[model samples]
Target chain A: MNHKNALTPWLFIGPAVLLLIMFSLLPILVSLLISFTDIDLIGLGNWDMIEFVAFENFIALFQDPLFHRSIFNTLVYVSIGVPLVIVCSLSVALMLNYMSNKLFSFFRVLFYVPSITNIVAIAVVWGFLYNMDVGLFNFILNSLGLQNVPWLEHPFMAKISLIILAVWKGIGINMLIYLAALQSIPRSFYEAADIDGANKLQKLRYITIPSLSYATFFVTVTTLIGWLQFFEEPFVMTGGGPLDGTMSMALFIYERGFQYNEFGYAAAASLILFIFIIVATLIQFTFNKSKEN
Target chain B: MKNRFEKLLITSALLIGGFIVSIPFIWMILSSFKSEREARTMPPTFWPQEFTFEHYINLFQNLNFGTYFTNTLIIVLFAMLGLLFNTMAGYGFAKFQFKGKEAVFIAVLATMMIPAQVSMIPVYLLLNQMGLTNTMSGIILPGLIAAFNIFLIRQFMTTIPNDLIESARIDGAKEFRIFFQIIIPLSKPVLAVQAILTFVGAWNSFLWPLIVANDQALYTLSVGLALLQGQHSSSFALQMAGATVMVIPVLILFIFVQRYIVEGFNTTGIK
Candidate 1:
């Protein structure tokens, strides 16, 4: 009976552990292995054809201009998009705190709807909205007696457009997160600030912002990681088009692995992406730690 | 005067932001009912002069969106079962004090940091090896028990009072019975939260489905919509119709249960 009790826990967790190992852990190891080889579609068919290239893929990837462009695009994306999302969400969350519950819930749903919709669908609508001739933005410009700006057609504008789409889909969850953190803040801190004759901005700076450091940190890290792996919107909206303007690292990797069937090179790119994410996350954590100190 | 001014400021800000935020959704729905020409017309009309369901009919006729919808439902249902299995494991971790449990939990948590992009190709290859590629099971297999979902369930289960489980144990209720009956029933709120999120996630999932399912019949709605867009790049109305089909179910679900969805993210953000 004691033995059975001991085994019961494993019985419960066994299936999940097994699946996690088979699907996640093993794949992670295999991907690392594959990154070192020339594992194309042909090698996928015949294991014997797989040749160990030992960082040759990585070496080749570094020389690949598209890979550099993808990395640069990803950095530009994460740098701009993450902060914009954070600031927007945090501002909305702060304002939300001042509203009535009934009104708050209404606005919450409005902000969150885009995030919940499929990116493919959002991309389609945005495509119409960004259409040069008949797109909504250009239409708005025409109505205002302004020359229509090529939104997705121009490389710089395409990156900005994709960033805008990302922030639209990303802000809801982060806003909700900030709201959660704000509500958890003790009321006395604000009351004390008020008694001290602190202005709203002063109180927000001294009290609210400091109080939300953890939420802000978590949001920053997660959103950065998300932006780093950005793919769908660019894929759907631009197809990484107009000279690979919106081609993200993740999309580049997808094109390599799936479209190009350069699985080994894709694996190498994925590992590099993985390393960048880890480094970024670690930097954020260290930054947070130093600030706390 | 000052308080009223501040209130007005906040209200206007929220209203303006809300309008901007809701534009895509409003456009998707309104454009779905427009003629293709009107949808693509310059200075795009805010309201369709004449509403039409032709695009809706066309989506089903040409795109066979119904098959994709059914395919998504199958994947979602199977994935839900897998989520329940994950929840059970979470319960075990929460209640049972077993050796190596902390290590296992940490291991699960650590896996969350490794982006799916890294493991995706290898996993796809593995699925191909198992002859699961291009099948619904292929989509369902890797997602069967996500580490993050397990972590979420564990966090929620830790909150369940131990007395109920202890009493059931005293009565000689089997471990599985206690888990299924006492623990699960008490965990309805979190379970509902997970259910709503999992549903939205599975429905909106794009990349993996795009990679795995080559058969058009087995394509999920998101993938199918992308395919529709590729095939009819200029048919704004038809694409909006496809987008509508994909968005409406989740949008409706959000309207009904958004509180749980918000609370879920508030507590356990894809952390």
Candidate 2:
């Protein structure tokens, strides 16, 4: 190894390392510290007025009904959204891999466009589509002689609308990941199966899915982490409306801190959510580890 | 006959899937040009019978959305500039020898798993203390140094050959100069990827901007577009026209950089 002077290395990384620490690392540590205090926007303006409150913020989070509802909403969403996005992506990937044509590859790129588009912007367009009197979805349903659905105004329907929107906006990227994985599988696997008189379904069962397990697990892990932190979509589209059925954990934390100016309580709630993601992620990883053996 | 039927099934399925995906965007564009009556009409018109530019005209004239648009562009450019600076740092971490570098790199990567929402309040406090709140800098400062970009760029730089660095070092080049001359020139792909991601994130950023940008003048296109949607009672169609205006930049951006953008998702997903 080329032994450069030690001081010189720090010189190269000094500015960037400093920026990351101040912006990312230090803020995270400070946030954890703030979770234990009773700080509000007033104290935010005057730092000395901030008072240490011990576990009161965490205790208060336990007492709040909205916190519980936020937890419940987050769970329901993660469970529903994670699996649906994975399955949709996997199915699309499978179809793309199975097809024999130039047009199939064309479809892949076209579908992936929305994956990169602004999630906030897409949520707005979809909010318009979910609009009761004027939305395209309700209009189409009404035109088909079906009962008009209150997509955003109703509670359960609002949550479902949020879920559907997430899956649609998110699936393209995950699909491409799986598509890359599926395409990399050797053709010999399928060819050998064909020689063994394996049908399409059997080949897929024995070879395709077995090979896709790694990609599936990776997609599931990241999707779970992302879904746990689901904020932008619900915030932009529904605003936790129609009896707060859709108030997510992240949104609650944001509203607690940003909107109502309850820094400690929001920070505590956020820490709790962060803990949940960590625990859930660990459980998923261990479960995946066992399945591998 | 049976094979033909199967082909028909697959064809129809693909068509339907593609149609569902494209329809929302197409509707957004169409509804923008429609009159309020046509927009809220009983069965919404699929195509505007009388296409009008009045809505587009209103978005520019009445709304003054150009300010938000320009604000987004400025913040986005600055964020991209920040991304370049961070990438150089990432390259240093990957290739350069520095005391505490490995520990520092791991520390930076570890922070990636920490949800950024938790830090929103503290960062707000930081900006408040610095007297930077409610400005574009409030939107841009915290965004400028991203852990994800650092991780991604370092991951890319680690793949570059060690000999290139050695050759440059033997030429008595300084670390920063070598990074700029050799590493960066060859790192165009990852840099392009970084540019697309940073630009998109900055352009579409809502939460941070929503919190920091307290004034109408400082609003990014995203927050402005949403607020505009909420403000207008006269014409929903006109509001859509405003959205079309907001989205046109991103769509045009994608049209040129489509491949890099796709490659971006793949790379980020890999991490």
Candidate 3:
């Protein structure tokens, strides 16, 4: 290539590459470095005051009860939310795929509304629905002669409530992913199954389910990573409240780093969360690979 | 008869499911129109006892809705600057042969795995050092060039015939001219998809803006609404109104561009 031609490409890409390095690439290393130091708001103003106490923050994070609670909460969220989202989204996709009517298309859009809407708005609305006295959920239960349930007040219930909202918000995109995958499956496979006198359930199990494996894998990874860093729902809904019932690792990081000004400690917690995500993702990849073999 | 029954069963199931999925949105919009007393009433009336725009009025008058809306618009609009630069980079990657290209592209892709939360604290500190904290630029700067967008655009551009660019070059056309005159027109579909996705993401973004812009005057709608929920904890009507105001624009945008958004998801699988 000519000198001018070689320079031309750099002209186009240089600005973005610079920004990416400054903002994204640099920050990862900086945050990692920050995790080892004893940095707080005061230290931020005076860098000399920050101490490089190696592994101290990490060790403290492991011992801290609040950190333990956040980890457990995040685990509960992923464990419940991932499977429920996949199953529910796939089920909805299957049901929608069975019909091709205009009404069903409308329903497809309806289901997707939550995914696109702002999470804070969703949290606020759901918070009202879960309100103690005049909430719609309790109102319905009262009409049926059942007692009111503490949706966000009880620690255990708060976790479940967050998962429910998360699943609802999450189902749309995964459903569409599955729907796309489902639509791509060749009809001949199902037709052949039918010709062999295979019932609907058998066709679904043997043909449809097997065909959706890749889409399932995709959904599982994305949703798993998403729920692992579960923050916005609980952040807006509970503020990790009711005795830290719904404190996600992401929220915990935000609370420690920003709320308490414990930047190094929060950085340690965030790094741990990042490691958990990478490990979880790698585990899924290994399991999928093993299954394929 | 069995076929008809099955169809009926499927439709009813979808109908019930759709209603259940829609209840939150339904409740939000309906409650936004309800008076404070009616909104808070036990065994809450599904329909407003009386239609009222008072909460919305209150949102604008008392809650600084106008400032929040304007701030959100500024951030989203400024963030679109990334799209231009990303498209240029994507084209460079797709069409040009350059040294260390593979390494650079892989580096960009690797950054995607590092979740935003990891970098957020440092980014905040960086902004603080630059005296950008509490500024709209602080919120807009970090999101200006996403690796995913560059990746998406490059993938789309690779499908464009190289012969078109080569012929332009043979005709003594400059690279920038070929890009603007020939390549850009062809890449409109991908550009549209990126623009829509970027707009939705910037509009709905919360945590970063919340962290960066602690000044109330700089709050985006999402951040403002979250704070509103906390400040007006008992004001159901006002909170619903704030939410309604925040959600309506995106919903309207979605209705118009629903096709491209869904198509974007199908093609990219990133949403």
Candidate 4:
């Protein structure tokens, strides 16, 4: 290393490092402290009104039915949503990579357009599609002599509606990742499989799936982490939904923090969610490690 | 011939896939031009029989979308500029060794796992104290120092041969000169990748801005759109118009930067 290296890194990184610590790291540390104190946004100046609350916020959250419901809904959303998104994306990816025709390239762009577009627009348009009377879905059902289903109005259906939109918005991205992975799988393996009299389906089953497992794991874990923090779609579309069927952990935290100004309680809830993500990440990392061996 | 049938099958699959994907976009644009009454009809037509720009006009007047558009642009530009400076620091971490470098790197990466949810209140409170609330700087300050961006640039810098830097040093170049003249010149691909990722991120950001930029005039595009929805309900045409407006800019950006966008993810070293 050059002699300048001793002085250079600090000189280069000093400003950024200071900023990250002060703006990002320091705030979270401050939050951990605030989570243990009953500090509301009454514009803090004197520390007289604030006092240590200990595990009271967490304890209260645990007792609250909304918190429990939020946890349940978050899990259900992640469990179902992640897999569906993965499958949809992976399928489209495979198809896009099945051949390099003009049409395939066009399909790639088509599938990806949704992923790149504004998600708020996606949620808004979907809200209309899920409208009970005016929606095209009901129109199709009515014309087909079937009963009109309320996509967003009902509890279970509302969850499904949000899932459908989420899948559409998300799948295109996962598809591209899977497509990239698919491209890297060696052609020689397929040639050998064909010579060994393996059919297309058999080759795909043995070769494609196993080869893409790493990408699958990566995609699923990231998607799950994102979904666990689900806020926008449900917040916009359902507003925690009919009978609290779709309240997610992130939205609940947002509501408690911003709406109620119950800072400590929200902080506790945020920590709980943070811990869930960490545990989930650890489990997946360990799983990948074992698979590697 | 048998090949003809195979081609037909593949072509059919592509057509169906394209249709499924493009329907929503087509519907979104189509519905935006329709009157609210026509838009809510059960049988959704592919196009408006009588087109109107009223919804689009209404958005500019009612929601103050021009300010939002400007706000998003300013935030995106400022964040990019801030990150460009940070990229210099990231290169230092990898290429320039110094005291406590490893510790600092580890510290930054460790903070990635700490979710933004926990940081929300304190950052807001901190900015409130500093009197930066409702300003673009408030939104941009926390994001200016990105651990991930630093890590990314550091990794990319490590890939450059030490011999190149050594030769530059042998030529009697100053430290800053080598960084600007040598390292920066060699780092185009990664710089493009980083810029696109950062741009998209700043453009789509919602939650932080939602908390900080409380005033309607100060609202960013995503926040503004959310507020537009809350303030005016049942104006399907107006919302679609607003949604379309919000989507177009990023869609245009993606079209130009598609290669860089994909390469950004590719550079993650997932394999």
Candidate 5:
């Protein structure tokens, strides 16, 4: 009876636990160990060919200009993209709060379409929009007698263009999150604010923003982590080009690992990317925790 | 008067936001109907002057979209089976109390924070070792049970009343029977939620599929669309048609299953 009791849970969870350990947990450990070694494609099967590099890969990455540039571009992406997405989504969510049920659901679905659509498809569509000559944006500029901007060709514009696409891709999910958060806030708080003669902006600043802090934290963390691992937009649309202008850390790691077959180097880069995610998330938690007190 | 004006302002803002959000999709669909010349013409055509199905024809006839769609179907099918396995594990966690249960659950939850990229290389190597590389199984294996999905199912299963299970056990019902007969039928909403999410995710997945299966025959719709874009880089209408084909199914699924999708995300996310 005791043995059966012990075995019952395992019977249910055994497959999932086995797979998770094999795939997720084991890979996590293997990757961490691999990050410490010098192992490439040829050394993949033959353990004898691998060497213990022990921080050499990390040191090398720190000195690599392209790696440095990738890190800088990722920071530029996160710092700008996270806040921009949050504000846009929040504003949309706030506006959405005013709509009737039928209208709100309609607009909600419209806003969410892009989030669910694959990023590659979105990139292709945006590529056409950002085309140098006959693109819609340039056509609009021409109509307004403004000079046609090289949206994806120029380095500065390319970064901005990539950020724009990221922001567009992200807004739908965050908007829905914020909208749900907003809907959960009790009406009594707003009633009290109104009775206290608080204006719209005052109510917003005090009640709405404070109510959204958790959602804001969630969004900021996710958006920051997402930007740190940014790959798809630049991969598809720009190919990390026209001058490595839109290259992100994720794309950089992918290029080194897959394209160059520098698996060891890519593993090291992936570890660094993991460290950035942890540090960023920890900072957000610390900030939120302190704010809570 | 103030209230009415406020309402008007809010409506206008939402309309503008909606318009901005829909423009690219609208343009993609519109351009799919335009001729190659019109699509690339100066001051690009917003509405195709004379609509045609040439691009759609080309997408099916030339691009082999049917194969890509079938590949995605196979991946999603296997992934759904994986979701069932996750639910069973979640049921175990939620109902059965064994040693180190809390510790085990937390460990699983913690895996959620470690991004998939961290594990990509080693997991790929593991797949290679299993001789699953370039097969749909390789693409499906690593994603069998994500921490988030396990957490989701666990959370849902915890709400199932204990007395029902106890009663079944008292009647000499085997644990598996109780799971398959009672718990699963009751957990329909969450199971449906997981199915929709898994379907959408597997359907949209690109990076893993791209890495695992390099063969043209095994390319999922997303990977296939990407490859199509590369080969027909200048064919705007053809690419748009491909995008339309890729997006339309998921969009249609969303329209029907959105309540489950929305509630699943909102509940899982906020909590």
Candidate 6:
């Protein structure tokens, strides 16, 4: 290699490496430092005004009922949202795989629509759908001679409503994932099952579900992590509630740092969320490993 | 007879499911065209009693939809710049020999686990210090180099045979020429994947734009729509129109490039 060529690789990778360091790597440490201090709007303006109060923000977070509520709400979202996403997406994938006509391809595109559309727009449409008096959902209920349900009013109902919308929006990409996995499973396995006189249910149980284990794991982990940081839907739809019923950890962090100007408090809250995510991901890894063995 | 029955069963199930899935989108578009009085009717009409474009006209005239659309386009355009930089890095990682290359690549992959929320506060502070806050650069800069894009491109480029580059170099091609003339053309499939994914992500991004652009003039479509929802909570037709305006472009884009977009997602899941 020539002298000029020795520097060629750095020329290629320099800009991306610099950016990754600036926005991602450095900020992780900076976030950790900020979490240890009391940095507010005034502190942001004047660096000297910031006070380093170690663990105080975390201590306060532990005692804060609102933070507690946010954590509980996040758990509720992940628990319900993750499973519902897996089941719905997997079922849709299995159905799509059963038929390979033009109509099925069209259905695949239709089902994938919500995944690509802007979330704020979807939230607007869904907000009207969840409207108490004249919403389509309530309209259907009343048409059947039933009372109107408060989709986003009652706290539990609000969580359920959010989960329903989430599942609706979330199933598409995962369904595609499962479909890809399904296509890759060798046809000969099914041919063998047929030779053994396996029925549809028996074939699905012994062959299809086992073949889909990795896709399911992938879908579950990604979906679980996504739900943990859930913010946009609740932020846009409920503004964290009729009564703080939908406050996710991410939204709580935003409300603290930006809305309340409690940057340090919010940083601490975010770090806790970060720890929760890392721990959750690690647990999932070990669990999946055990299942495989 | 049984085979035909099974086909009928699956088709009906998919048809019913597709309708249920599309109801909100259908309702949004339908309601956007409804007259204001009809939009608010109790037990809402399935079809508009009187279709009109008044809400869309109002959105353009009064709501600053033009500014929001322009801002969103600018962000997306700048974000596409990342594809070039990432592809360069991906090519370097895939084809070139360097010290600590594996370590650097693994580090890039590891950063994917760190949530954007973790760095968000400091990034805001960093931008404020740099005097970029509330500017288009503020929204554009943080997301300009995603690790995932670099990873995707590198994996794709690895499959291109190294002999193509070696032969071009033997014919007196310089390093940069080899990359631009030889490698880039071969990498089009992955580049298409990267471009479409980047365009969709940048266009639909909300939280970063919301955080960085406190100025209403700088608000992108997503933030603008959220603000519209807040400001006009009772204007059912107006909000629906705003949403339709935002979604129509994406839906159209999907229809045109649905294959590339779907394949891009499948690669992410299966790879």
What is each predicted model's overall lDDT from 0 to 1? 0.88, 0.81, 0.90, 0.82, 0.86, 0.89
Error of 1 at B125 (Å): 1.0
Cα RMSD (angstroms) for every candidate in the order listed: 1.6, 2.3, 1.6, 2.1, 1.8, 1.3
Could you tell me the lDDT of residue B244 within candidate 5? 87
**Model 5 C-alpha lDDT per residue in residues B1-271, reported as the tens digit of each score:** 9999998888778889889888888988899999998899886767899999998887778778888989989889988888888998899899998998888888888888777677788888789888998998888888878887888888888988998998888888888999999999998888888888888888888988988887888998889989988999998888888888888888999999888766766655462
Please tell me which model should have the higher lDDT, number 3 or number 5: 3
Mind giving the per-residue lDDT tens digits that candidate 1 earns over A85-166?
Answer: 9999999889998866788789988987777788999998899888887788887778789998999999989999989998
Question: Which runs of model 5 end up more than 4 angstroms from their true locations?
Answer: A1-4, B265-271
Q: What DockQ do you compute for every candidate structure?
A: 0.70, 0.53, 0.68, 0.61, 0.66, 0.74
Rate residue A235 of model 3 by lDDT.
92
Residue B32 of model 1, lDDT score = 93
DockQ for candidate 3: 0.68
Question: What's the TM-score, to 2 decimals, of chain B in model 4?
Answer: 0.91
In model 3, the runs with Cα more than 4 Å from the true position are A1-4, B269-271
Question: C-alpha displacement of B48 in model 4, angstroms?
Answer: 1.1
- For residues A149-249, write the lDDT of model 3, one tens digit per residue: 99999999999999999999999989999888988899999889889999988999999998998999989998998888899999999999889999989
The DockQ leader among the candidates is 6
Candidate 1 C-alpha lDDT tens digits along B1-271: 9999999989888989999888878888899999988887665678998999999988888778889989889888987888788898889889889899999989888889889889888999999999999988888888888787887888888888888878778788888898888888988877888888888888888877899999898898899889888889999888888988988888888898987877776555442
Q: What is the TM-score of each candidate against the true structure?
A: 0.97, 0.94, 0.97, 0.95, 0.96, 0.98
lDDT of 6 by residue, A108-213 (tens): 9999989988999999999999999768889888989999999999888999999999999998889988989998899999999999999999999999999998
- Candidate 6 residue-wise lDDT, B76-192, digit = tens: 898888888898999889989988898888888877888877888888888888999898888989999988888888888888898888877777789889999888998777788
Cα lDDT tens digits for candidate 3, B30-124: 99999889998876888898999999888899889899999889878876888888999999899899899999989988887888789898888
Please tell me the interface RMSD, in Å, for model 2. Answer: 2.5
Ranking by DockQ: 6, 1, 3, 5, 4, 2
